[model samples]
Target: MSAALRPFDVAAIRAEFPILQQQLEGKPLVYLDNAATTQKPMAVIQAITDYYSQCNANVHRGAHQLADEATRRFELSRDKVASFIQAYDRCEVIWTSGTTEAINIVANGIAQRLKPGDEVLVTEMEHHANLVTWQQACLRSGASLKIVPIHDNGALDTEAFAALLSANTRLVALPHVSNALGTVNPIQDLTRLAKAHGALVLIDGAQGIAHGGVNVREIGCDFYAFSGHKVFGPTGVGVLWGKAEVLQDWPVWQTGGEMIAQVTYHSATWGELPNRLEAGTPNIAGVIGLAAAIDWLTQFDVSAIQAHERALLAYATTLATDFEGIQLVGTAADKIGVFSFVLQGSHPADVGFLLDKQGIAIRTGSHCAQPLMQRLGLPGTARASFSVYNTLEEVDALFRALKKTQRMLA
Candidate 1:
């Protein structure tokens, strides 16, 4: 919590986003599906429009005036991203399509070092994107994947994570925050344990970064990945931050026009860290929009935002606690602003549909985390995730809607 900020005013903050003012079915929208993707503000939208309309040109290749302006804006975005995460160097950052692609980049690029008997350790709580890529990587390189178990409360069993690290462990990958459960892992300690076994660490910040700040050098993880859409930015752009040295050593996963240094008919050299990773014209508008989103987000007081979310989460939990047959899926000590729960007799999809009729938006089903759903011994749960834009009034509306839903089923 920063000292300069005062207590958050939800009403004041809500005014900035015009989309939230709209109605569905003659009712005001109550958007509770933030974990799926946050709604973008006018700032982010305007940033994209401004870039294409004014400074429309290619970057890094042209010597002309418009090209130089485009290049400057693009590089400014890079610096903004680097500062947002507190990266050691701006060059450590590389852009990708989204979290899935970022994770895949590491999985595929690191394949050159993996061989039979080498292990890539993960956990049971991982999203399929994280799980499947490593599964394929292990299959290709003859490396094996290991899963660390979670406690019944949905928190990572850190003791179990420590116990799983062996001499053959080459990589340990985990999420900073679980998209399904909202569990915030102790990544610092996890990284330390992995480092003790001479294993590199990759922390998936897809669900974590948008809600809170991240310091890459402080966390000391080898790699961190997150998506733009999750953070009020455009959908197509994502970030993969690595220690510059580690990124330099990883084999190039993609190759094309922009990534090349010299070309013969036979062999060619590649560009530097980011340029080598980015192989084409890139998502120009998406990147610019993301930069605008980051800039807009940075303007608010983070402490106030955190306090508001915590209060709203507490309120939501109180309402949910009274439902007799309902079961809260994840009760981890450290959770973000997400709630996943199931009524004993109700299917998640049915609840989702009913809520939509009330002009309430929430996500239901596996949430790209089918394994986690199976672990909880359920088909799925309806999840309501909050952001800075959500209000106590919206939370009350959700509770009223849920009570209505429970009665209709009864």
Candidate 2:
């Protein structure tokens, strides 16, 4: 690896993100809304543009030249995703509209096999995307949805999680990291506990994939889902990985043109693991853009990226904690460069609006983790999440903006 591949070259990395260079409200855009969606790089943008320009065709349905090119690119994107997560085979990778769709696919597929009186386990820290799908699935299947509560520090109670696992537990869906609190959970440990109880495991990796790279096989998880937008790709693409045998046993959730092997009024057969799950026409250009994003990420050492983000997290946390009346939510030993905090007597939305005038974009709300917010006894939190393209200067800018907000409110 080159020396520039080392962590903390914020200047060089920021240059690749053209949007960050532009002004918002007459100031440079200090993008800290990474938890919502990351800013795309030139490579990803170009990939999407080039695909639509040259390879626009329906995938897996035609024999024309454009279709062939589009199909090749689309399938190649699946391969790239499989490699990105170190899955056993590309067949294990299924593309969806985004993480919400991916989780819904798992919930629906597993719901088909569930019986009344069964249970599905989850935690209070889950994003609504992970929570509601299982909740609805259990309701439809006549199975119960069991939740493991969190401690005051916003960490999952592992012992409580263990207690929730039982012979009747059909599945355990949990987040690898909390989107609201940046709490990194012990996914492997949870998977082991669920497996020991003879239950399947699914991990929601939306925030986890943004901070650290994952290998689904290494995690020993039955299923893993994440969105491309969280990992610097386009918004429309996401991935769901399952064990080949597990997916092979799943009934098709949707039916349409490309996923069918053969069809009749009385009988229809679906394709293999991935195609069976991915019904209808796939998102060709978005998938191609995701592949390019993965390629761009692979060019630099991931270890260096993790290290850089950790350093930034430490600095940012220290700065934020120094301010009075600012309460930090999650205090996990392991966390991504995400911080959610609340200033005394100030609503998160107010803080967010004040910061926006300075061109510091952040997320302020329940962050789709309403259960977590309820557990913490707050309405919501102001969240500043970092990406590799963010710099120390941007972190300083955030502090300055927060101080200005504080002064104005006081």
Predicted candidate 1 versus true structure: per-residue lDDT over 1-410, tens digit per residue: 46655446677767778899999878999999988899898988998898898988898888798888888888888899999999989888898999999999999887878999999999988999888889899999999999999999899999989999999999999999888988989999899889999999999999988886788887889999999999999998999999998998678878898888898999999988788898988887888888998987887677666777778888888887876777888889899888888877999998889889999999999989888888888899999999999988999998888888888877
Give candidate 1's TM-score. Answer: 0.97
lDDT of 2 at 104: 89
- Clash pairs for candidate 2: none
* TM-scores of all predicted structures: 0.97, 0.97
Candidate 1: where is the Cα deviation over 4 Å?
1-7
In angstroms, the error of model 2 at 333 is 1.4
lDDT value, residue 279 of candidate 2? 81
Model 2, span 97-197: residue lDDT tens: 88899898888888888889899999999899999899889888899999999888888999999988889999999999888988889998889889999
Worst 10 residues of 1 by lDDT: 1-10
Instruction: Provide the lDDT at 50 for model 2.
Output: 88
